[model samples]
Target: MAITSANQLELLQTAEAVAREKMIEPELVIEAMEDSLARAAKSRYGAEMDIRVAIDRKNGNATFTRVRTVVDEELLENYQAEFTADQAKPYFEPQKNAQNIWLRDGAPVEDFAAGPQIGDVFQEQVPPVELGRIAAQSAKQVILQRVREAERDRQYEEFKDRAGSIINGIVKREEYGNIIVDIGRGEAILRRNEKIGRESYRPNDRIRAYVKDVRRETRGPQIFLSRTDPQFMAELFKMEVPEIYDGVIEIKAVARDPGSRAKIGVISYDNSIDPVGACVGMRGSRVQAVVGELQGEKIDIIPWSEDQATFLVNALQPAEVSKVVVDEDAPRIEVVVPEEQLSLAIGRRGQNVRLASQLTGLDIDILTEEEESRRRQAEFNARTQLFMDSLDLDEFFAQLLVAEGFTNLEEVAYIEQDELLSIDGVDEATAEELQARARDVIEAANREALENARGLGAEDSLIEFEGLTPQMVEALAKDGVKTLEDFATCADWELAGGWTTVDGQRVKDEGLLEPHGISLEEAQDMVMTARVMLGWVDPDELAAAAAADAAEDGDAAADAAPAEDGARTEEAGA
Candidate 1:
C-alpha cells in the first residue's frame, strides 16, 4: 500500500470502522494509525531519527515530520534526533531574518533574540514512505494490538462501576467448571463455587448474576459474576419490591445458605411501610419471585432492629425464644428457647443459628430453657462456694452473698460496706468481718499470682504497669510477654482476643489477658499508656493528635448540621 492523496480518506474510514466494531473512540483508532505510520516511516528513514505522524481529523491528510531537539553540548547523544544549542544557529537564522523583515514592514514582531535555546524543538516536513509487505504487516499488527488494548480499556471502564449490581448475560461456554457469560460488549466469568447448587447452564442460556468484582488484568478486564452471593438475593428483592427500590424500605443485612434457606433483615424509613410485609408482598408474590430465582431457597424476611438481641430473635423466626443473654465483651449471644423449639431454632445442622449469627454479626449459642436454668444454677453454686471458702461464711451466709450479686472475693473486698450490711440479717459488724476476710483472701491470691509471675521471669516494669492485674501479669509472663516493652508491642486484638477468618470460617484467637476480662479498648489504652511511660511515644504529641481529631470531628458535625436542618425543613414543608 502506498501513501497517496487518493487513499488518505480511506485511512480515516478504516479507522472509524475499526473503532465502531471495537466500541472505542474513533480518535483513539486514528492515534493508533498515526503511531503505526510513524513506525513505518522510522523504518524507511533512519531508525535513530525521531519520526512522527499526524492525521488531520477533518481531511484525513497524513503529515510526516522529523523532530530534533536542541540539548546541552554535554547531553547531546543521538546525532540524528538531538543537536547541541551551538549547532542550532543555522535553524534559527531564518527565523531571525523573518523577524527583521516584519519589523521593517511595520508589522508586529515578537522577540527572537534568544532563539533556539536548549530544550527547543525543530520540525521539518518529510516525504511519505511507501509501505512494503513487511512494513505493512508490522503496521497491521500494531494497529490490531492498539485496538485490542483500547477495547480492553473500554470494557474495564464500563464494568468497573457496575460491581455490586445485577447483570443479565447469556451463557457463552463452560471452561474448567467455570461458566463464561456473554455480558454485552464483553465476557464475564462465574466460578463454579459462585453458582447455586446443581444450577447448570448450557450455551445460549440466559442467566442473571451479581457483578461481584471487575479487575483489570494483563489479558483483559475480568468481570466476576456470582449467583450464590447474599447480595444477589437482596438485589432480587430490590428489583421485585418497589418500596426498596424507592428507598422507603431498606434491606439492612442479608445471609444466604445458597440453595438452602436464607435470612434478610429489613427496615422501613416510613412508619406505615412495614418493611417485612412490603418485601413479602401480596400473597407472597414478591418473596416467591426471589425464591424461584434462588432455586426454591427459603427466605426469612425479618424486621431489622437496632437492638441486636431483638434482631437475632427475629432472625431465628418460627422458633420461640424464651430468654436472651448477651455478652457484649465477647460479642456473643446465648438464646434460650423452649425444649420443643430447640431443634427448630438450631435448624437442620445448625443452619438457622448460623444464618442468625451472620445476619446479626455475632456468634450465637442456642440452648433450651432447661439447659439455661441448669447453667444458671451451676454459676450460682460456684459463686456460693467461692464466698464460703474465701469469706469463711456458712452455706446460708454464702448463698445470701451470692444472691446479693457478690460473685467474687474482689467484689466483696472492694464494695461499700453498706452493701453487705443491706443483706438480710447482716449487721455492720458482720459486714466488717466478711469484708476483712474477703480482703485477706484476695490479697493472698494476688501475692501468690505475683510470686508465680516472678518465678516465670516477670519484670517489675510489667508488674507495675497499673492497668494490668497480678493475674494478668502472670498470664503475660506465661505467654513470654514479661516486660512493659513486650506488652506495648502487642496488638490490641492479641491482648483482648479476637476472631480471625481462616478458610472462610471464623476461628478464635485466645488472648493472654482475655480470662482477666480485659476489653479491647482497655487493652489499647493500657498499651498506649505503657508506650508513653517507656518514652517510645511522646504524650504531648498524642494529646495534640487527639485534639486535632476532635476538632475535625467537631467541624464535620457542624457542617452536617445545616444540611440536616435543611432536609428536615424540606420534609416539614412537604
Candidate 2:
C-alpha cells in the first residue's frame, strides 16, 4: 500500500497532460522533466558531483544515481571521468604486475593489470530524498522553460516547411492593431498593413490568409500572414481551380489593388485547355470563390501570351485595343484606344492601367487615335521647318524632302544626284542647282555660326580647339555649354538626346545634338576630351585628340553638305 501511494503516477499523468496540451511527444516532456529534476538535484548535491534522474516510462517510479566513466589516465579529454590505478583502486580489483610490465609512475607495483581501459562506464546509486518546496519550485520552473523551448522548436519545424501555403486560422485577439491567429498547433500574426482594405475580423472568426513568411525568433517562430498580398489571391484560386492545381493552367503573374480589383495572367501549357476558361470555372464559380475570399475583390482572369504585345492587350481587359506601339529600347508600350474607352482603359484614378503595367512588366501609355495623329503631324512640321531654315529650301521643297523619308539634313546631303533627279518636277539642272545652293547655304551658315558662337561668349580655349567646328561651337554656346569644363559635366543624353518628362511619362526629346547626328559614343568621347583639356584627366591628348579629330571631320562633312544630298551618293554610284 505504501509503494502504491508513492508510485508517482501523478507525475507520469502530468507529463502526458502537458504533452497533449503542448502538441509534443510525451517522451520528450518526460525527458525534459527528468533533466530538470537532475539540474535541481545538482543544486543540493553540489554541481561538481555527477547527478542524474531517470523516470520510468511504464510506471511513475523514479531512480537517482551518480555516473562515473573510467578512461585511460593518459586521455585528459575525459579527465573528469578518467582515473589512474591508485584513484580507482577502490572500484577495480588489482592483480600482480607481470615481468617487464611498467606502472604509470614508471615504478614496479604489486598490481599493474591493464585496468580501466578507455570508456569503462561505472554507476553509483544515490539515496533519494524528498525535495523541499524551494527545490521543487525550481524544478518546476526549469521543466516549464525546457518544455516551452521544445514546443517552440516543434512549431517552427512544422510551419517553416509550410511557408507560402494558404492556411486557415481563427482570430485569437488583436494586439496593437495586429491580429493574432490560432492556426491549430501554433499562433500566427496578421499585421494591420497586410490585411485587405476595409476588411475586419472578429474574435473566433474563421479566416484564411497566405503564409507570407516564417521567422524563428528568440521567443518563438513568427508566422506572418497576409490577405492583401498578390500571392494570396493566386493561392486562393489554386485552391478553387483544379486546372491550376493540376498544372493544366499556370498563373504567370498577379497584381492586386487588394479588395478593389485584381488581375491574373494565366497561360496553358496544354493546348487543349483554355487557361482563362479553366480559371473561371463553370459559370465563373471558381473565380467567384476566390473573389469571395478576398472580400469581393474584382478578379480579371486574363489569358497570358508569349508575345509581349498580345499579353499587354489581354492585361488591359474590358477595354478594346486599337493599336499598340512598342518601344523596345525604352521598355515602354503605347496603347491607342477608342476615345470613349480612355477612362475605362485607364480605370478610376488610373488603377486599371497601373495594374496592367504591374502584370505586364511594361510601362503603358494610353493615348487616343487623334492624339497619335496630331503627334505625327507635329513631327512632320518640325522637320519641314528645320529643312527650310538650314538649307535655304522653300516650304514646298522642304515638304518634298520630308515626304521622301528624309528626317535630317545628312540624309539629303548624302543621297545620289540621280535620287534627287528622280523626284517628280525635278531635272538634272535643277538637281545641280539645288545641290550647289545647299553647299553655299551651309558654307555661309558656318561663317555666320562662327560669328554667333564668338558673340555668345564661347571660350577662346574651345574656339582654338583643333577638332571643334564653328557649327559645333555655336551649338555648344547656344546650349550654355561653352567651356571644356562645362561640356565635361553633361550626360550623354544631354549631349546627344533623351526624352523629356511629361505627366511622369517620357515625351519626345528635342536635344540640339540630335539634329547633328551625334552618336552616344561620340558624345562620350567629347566629354572625355573636355576632361583631358582641363587637365582633370591624365594626358590622353594623342588618343583623345585623334578621336576628337574624327568626330570633327564628321561634323565638318555634315556642315559642308547640309541637305546637299547628292554629295556622297554620286561617289557610291561611281
| lDDT on C-alpha atoms for all candidate structures | 0.85, 0.77
Against the true structure, what is every candidate's RMSD?
A: 6.1, 14.5
Summarize candidate 1's per-residue lDDT along 1-574 as a digit string, tens digits. 6786456788889988998888899999999999999999999998999999989998888888887777899887899999987787666543433212212123333555776566666666788899999999999999999999999999999999999999999999999899999999999999999999988999999999999999999999999999999999999989999999998888889998899888888877777667777888787888888888988888887877776677777888778888889877665789999999999999898898999889988888889988999999999999998887777778998998888887788898889888877888999988888878888887898999999999999999999989888999999999899998999999999999989999988999987788889988898899999999989999999999999999999997875311100000000000
Among residues 3 or more apart in sequence or in different chains, the pairs in candidate 1 whose N, CA or C atoms overlap within 3 Å are none
| Best candidate according to lDDT | 1
Candidate 1 segments exceeding 4 Å error: 95-110, 532-574
Worst 10-residue lDDT window, candidate 1: 564-573
lDDT (Cα, 0-100) at 9 in candidate 2: 89
- Report the CA-based lDDT of candidate 1 relative to the real structure: 0.85
Each prediction's number of clashing residue pairs: 0, 4
lDDT of 1 at 344: 90
Q: Candidate 2 at residue 350, lDDT?
A: 93
lDDT, candidate 2, 307-379, per-residue tens: 7888888788778889999765443589999999899899999999999999987878999989988987998
